[model samples]
Target: MKIWGEIMGKADDVMDICLLAGQIMLTYGAETYRVEETLERMAKSASFSNIHCFATTTGIFLSFEEKKEKEDLMQMVRVDDRLQDLGKVTDVNQVSRQFVAGDITIEEAHEKLTAIAKAPMQYPLWLIHIAAGIAGGGFSYLFGGGWFDLIPAFIAAVVSSIVVVEFERHLKVRFAAEFTAAFAGGTTAILLVLIGIGSNLDQIIIGSLMPLVPGVPLTNAVRDLMSGDLLAGVSRGAEALLTSLSIASGIALTISVFL
Candidate 1:
């Protein structure tokens, strides 16, 4: 009787661990398709047969097998965090997963990540001006415009980068989009606003904004790649590059009437 009870108890603990791990991974940003895979691996390691995982944008649930056959498989869940750290770590998503894996508490991650996230992130206006001038002037020179047009090109780089920053601030403070959409939309909106102001966006594209926008993602991807998050780093880099192109394209479309 004693032996049977001990076996049942160990089984229960395994189930508990699997269910908790699943819930935590979902919250950690695990995709729905991968949730079941994770749960299966966890359950097998935990030594169970009844393995399943369910999830939505809003929730995650899991079931595990044990010695208690036909018993109701348990489920565990938790609420979202009101506060979270969004810092630039060498491996961005790994921190989130580590936080979920019981390796480190959320509070600890938040503290460390907060510090990194708030770190100084800006390029001085003078450099921006020079970069923009070079880019715009070079493009103009390539396309048969006079050297004087480089002035507007320089101004364009400065303006575009500034607009991205300003737009990013509005999204963070007002609308609350995170790094991805905020970065993309912010750059886009800034260009739009410039066009609305009658500034030549074509010159801006030739300007230094490309360097400004690419810096963050490039940094983030480097961080991820260094952290051994190859997939994530590549994805972020691709996203950054694509977003930069999108902004340039948007500007081109808006001003194409002159061509």
Candidate 2:
């Protein structure tokens, strides 16, 4: 009876650990199917043959069927905060793979995941600023902006990235922060055009706007729909739509004011 108790306790602990790992992946912008697959894999690692998991954009559900007890171990976790951190997603995948391969115990897996969750930025702030500027300029050139327009576009994008990064430090809502950043980009482009810094206002503005695009959300939404997760897909699609509209409105409002 004591050995049986220990077995049940260990099972419970593994379940909780798996749930926490899934939660971290979901909250950090992993796809629904990926989260479910990872949870299933983790359960298999613990010798469970009957594990079912359902993950959406905002929540996760997991259950393990116990053959002897004729009962199911169930857990539901609510996820509120969502962010796009590809690094975290990749790290979680590695940790899950390690756990399944018997490379680490459940407690060790939990500690590794926690550390990944708390990991700092991989790149410095100034490097991000430089990359943003280069991306803006390169995209503008690709979109047919002439040589003269590159400098203006670069400057606008750098300034936009800085403003958005600063706003993010204080703003909890992503939409608000994106809108403010887009508006700053628009305002900068218009000012540059007025001062004869660039001849093509449209090119410069478009380039600067590239940074605020919701690429990951849209891609994930499409993938979710393809995987038959209609509700999660629709929810993510709506978020992407709102972000696009916010960006457009920022530019339109700025142009309207100048006219």
Candidate 1: residue 209 Cα off by (Å)? 10
Instruction: Give the alpha carbon lDDT tens digit for every residue of 54-109 in model 1.
Output: 54423556776564554446665652421111223233345445544657643455
- Residue-pair clashes per prediction, in order, are 4, 0
Residue pairs of candidate 2 with colliding backbone atoms: none
C-alpha RMSD for every candidate: 10.2, 1.7
Pairs clashing within candidate 1 = 90-223, 132-208, 133-154, 136-206
Model 1 quality (TM-score): 0.37
For model 2, how does the per-residue alpha-carbon lDDT over 58-128 read when each residue is reduced to its tens digit?
88999986566655788889998887678888989999999999999988998998898788867888898
TM-scores for every predicted model: 0.37, 0.93
